[model samples]
Target: MTIALRDAREQLRDRFLFWATLALVVASTASLVTGAIALHSDAATYAAARDQLLALGKDAAAIAAPEFYPLKLMRGMIEQVEIMGAVIALVAGYRAAAAERGRQTLALILTRPLPHWAYRLAKIIGGMGLAAVSLGIVIIATAILLPVVSGIGLGTDDALRLALTWAAGVFYLTVLFTLGFGLSLWARSPASGLIAAFALWILVVLVAPQIGDTMDPDNQVAGGVFAQLSVPKAEQDRIKAGFAGYETFRNGIEVASVTKHFERFTFAILGIKDTYTGAPVDKVLAEKRGDLLFLFLFSLGLGGLVLLRPINPDRLTKES
Candidate 1:
């Protein structure tokens, strides 16, 4: 508790965390505004359709009003988090490890009455708490800006879904934080961790997803290649079924990315994915079980490494 609070205050003051949080807020506000415009358009269309049906004398009971999930307005916010959120966590992790090494703070902490592993464990817990704070501010902004921009109040169901997505975001950031922190500790030089972290980020967060998307025969063209060519869904599936090996390889690349799983889980929860739109929360969670497992295992693995990796102060002191 002591360490976690101190981590929050200290990281917020650091230039990296301060600037990252500010930039994320600015970008997410814009995404939510754009989402609002889309929601209002959908609402207007629903109203027009309802009126048209009434004029046709359709039974009132037959004309069920469309369900509007305003939480769909946060798709852009999710993507922004997918990108910038990793940076925030990575920087926090790097600074936590690198700064302490430069100051020999870990060595000094080890000399205290506390057990050898206590400070390390506390620092990691502190790091996670720090990530939660950074993402919490964005989620709060999302709650505020969503209704104001779209003129549609978020329903209790949608609010609960949004909260679920927020929790997933915090977990996703925790994984990245541990990865960065662990790398910093393991690297011989302080700079290698930051470089390697960004390299993996570029690969897993950015490149892998693109490769998967572009590899899909349906996604090659604007507005979807299959749609543009007037391809039927059944035919598309049948056609791709013959190339199962190719599909498997492409999916394998995407599955390696923690960001992809985070996006998939959150998208299904928030109805950003078309198939999941209007799906019940329980059903969506059940369907996305694989993604949830990946996220959980990713966090558990990274956290285990950070806690268990051999820590040598001699290596830190030697890294001129």
Candidate 2:
């Protein structure tokens, strides 16, 4: 616990990490604010139209009031975290291993009361705590900003769903942190380890997400292809069934992307996906479980790799 606390505090005081967290908050806040403004405007327009219809003697009760989902407004928040959060994890991991490799500490800790497994676990615990608390600030900001931006407060269910999405973010961040931590420990130099982490981040967080999104047939057209063409659900399924092989290939690529899984799981909870919007919490969980599982597997795999290292003090030592 002490080590964990120390790890977190060091991160809090880190100049690079401070700026990264601030950037994440500012960027995501912008996204949430923009989405909220759009929603507020649309709702206002709908209300005005409804009022005009009623003034003309039309039944006002027949028209539906606009539903404002504060949680859905968090789509931008999710994106910011998806990109920046991974970078933060990598940096944190690089620092954690680097700290242990210091001249005064490496030999003593690796050879003393702290076994390599215990040392690795403590670092991970500390880093995980750091990731959680840092990323958690985004949620707090969302809660505080949502009402102010959208003129709507979060409902209990909305709050719960947002919490679930935030948890997914923490999990996603943790997996990346583990990756960075493990890779740095294996690399000959901390700088190389950090670079390697960023390379994978580019592949998974940046490139892979683009590949998956563009390959999505629905996304081929603005506002979704099927919706744009006014295709019925049954027919849409039929059309999709005809391209089973292509879809399988696309999904295969998406399945390989940690970013896509995080986005999928988060989007479903936030109701960003029209199909999942207004769907019961249980339904969202059941359907999105696969994506969450992939993230969990990443955490597991990276963690195991970290733990299984030979525990050599020489490896943790710096090049002389």
Compute the lDDT of residue 77 as modeled in candidate 2.
85
Which regions of candidate 1 deviate over 4 angstroms?
41-67, 113-116, 229-233, 318-320
What TM-score would candidate 1 get against the native? 0.88
Task: Please provide TM-scores, in order, for all candidate models, with all chains considered together.
Answer: 0.88, 0.90
Cα lDDT tens digits for candidate 1, 227-290: 7989899998898889999999999988888999999999999998888999988899898978
Best by TM-score: 2
**Where in model 2 is the C-alpha error above 4 Å?**
44-63, 230-232
lDDT of each: 0.82, 0.82
CA error at residue 5 for candidate 2, angstroms: 2.6
- Flag clash pairs in model 1: none
Shift in Å, residue 252, candidate 1: 0.4
